[model samples]
Target: MPQSSPRLIGVGGGKGGVGKSIVALTIARVLSDRGDEVVLADLDLGAANLHTYLGIHGRVPTLSDFIAGGMADLSPLLVDTPMPRVHLIAGGVGSLKTANPTFQSKMKLLRHISRLSADWVVLDLGAGVHYNTLDFFNAAHYRVVVTQPEAGAVLNAYGFIKSALLRRISRVFSKDKNLTKALEERVSTTRSRGLLTFCLTDRLSMSPILRGLMMNTGRD
Candidate 1:
């Protein structure tokens, strides 16, 4: 039988206090309870507090260690959580540099994450629409956007989605500078009017890959 690839689920939001980590943890627990080995990664970088939510105190080896070359393999940094079948790689607290890791470092981490020996890998991304955050969110097989009932939360959530879409478009057409420029102009004009003011048909016609990005949004 052919081996199945590990599932990558990224949970993110536009801002803090939106229950992003809570959702990620809940999903991890559910998966682990089903007998799947799960790795819950706190990818927030700058202000990581997932450990606090999990009731983990004191310092633990984090992504910073791996990024700083303190560890060769990420497995060593995987602190065993109290939950069965669930392990965690805590995020670096106040690691501002990690907020904007180099492309090479991002690629290295993503590669290691893909190769992790687990049934599911849940990445809890930081709030905001920073390029780094969006890149990680896009890397996942499934992406979930968390939001609240407040108007501000809703607006921020919209901004986050628009930013992700624009970033994806830019990346897809990066080689074609003129085409990318045109897309950016269109996105800007549309955003000035309203969220999702652009035509869905046009975006869908651009590329199957992009269409997939729009439609593949998973629930948290």
Candidate 2:
């Protein structure tokens, strides 16, 4: 039988200073305590700082090396953390382009993440609705959005979830330019009306492609 892929968990949020990294670290530590090998990836790009939380002060290879073509695969970038059974793939602190990776580089990273040998892979995604961050968060089997108790934090969290959902929906209809345009227009209009869910449901009913996606999502 073929080897099973690791379970991916992404921790993300819309706003900064919401403690996404802490939540991701705690999840990794808890899983490690249970004897599971965990690979915690800091996908925070330009602002990568998970190593500080783990007490790793030395310089190490990061996802930047892999994205920049300096490294062949993510395995070489893995650094052992203080937590037993929990390793880290540090984030890059390179140029602006490295912080905002292209679509192809993002896809390559996601592919390698799926192939990691660990039992669980926890991704600490950067805050905001950047395409790269949204894609990484959606790639995970389990998605977690962190937030604080303040009104701004709650609103940002809601926005993050909404953006992630829209991004996923757009990808599903990417092959159909007409449908994608229609979906974008509907989102913009419905968002202003505060009728996003109902409006999207109505639009989905009109498109066979969207209907199929809804059915598949229900099954999943």
Candidate 3:
């Protein structure tokens, strides 16, 4: 049977202990309660603890299994949760190898996720601004950057957003060398002028397409 294209949602935090996993779990529960098939993927690779929040104890076949060639199909790895219609693809326990998956493996996992038979696929991304984390954030249809109401958390959240924006810019024009070069030059100029003063409008000024994308962000 053909699967419906799942709506991808990413809940991320710039720092640890910001309740990103909690938010992801809550969203998944809400969606599932509404009769939507939801798959919560704990993509917090290095320090995945979403399962703990979901109250899922014991062993589970994580993304590690797929990466290690132990599992071919991801569907079999979905673990049933207490919440009806909400499934989980745990990030697995321990094992740094699972944490630092190769670029190819990450891409493969993403492809497999896109085909999941779920109404929504919520990815609980790891903390920090690593490329791996940002890639998942950029791919999500709804990107939620969670942060506490503290000075450090606020600052880190801003930093994460900045990095994510930069990553998106590079990805959008990666194939066009000239455009990429031009963007780099613009970024340098912006930084030279006033790095602290840089804003979203300035970043979006380079490409109308990007500007349009920014405008449309968060719209269902």
Q: Write the per-residue lDDT of candidate 3 for residues 117-202, one digit (tens) a residue.
A: 89889999988999999999888877777787789998787778778777878889999988977886676455423444454334
The C-alpha TM-scores of every prediction are 0.83, 0.82, 0.81
lDDT agreement with native, every candidate: 0.79, 0.81, 0.79
* Candidate that beats the other on lDDT, 2 or 3, i.e. the better one: 2
- Model 1 C-alpha lDDT per residue in residues 1-220, reported as the tens digit of each score: 1146577888887978888888888878877876889899999987888888888899788888888875667888788888999989898887766767888898899888888888888999989988889988878877677788789988887788778878988999999999988987887667445554433333444335324444443443
Q: Judged by TM-score relative to the true structure, which candidate is superior, 2 or 3?
A: 2
Tell me the alpha-carbon RMSD of every candidate. Answer: 5.7, 8.3, 6.4
lDDT of 2 by residue, 89-206 (tens): 9997755877988899999999999999898899999888999999998898776667887899878877887788779879999999899888877665555345456435444543
lDDT of 2 at 98: 72
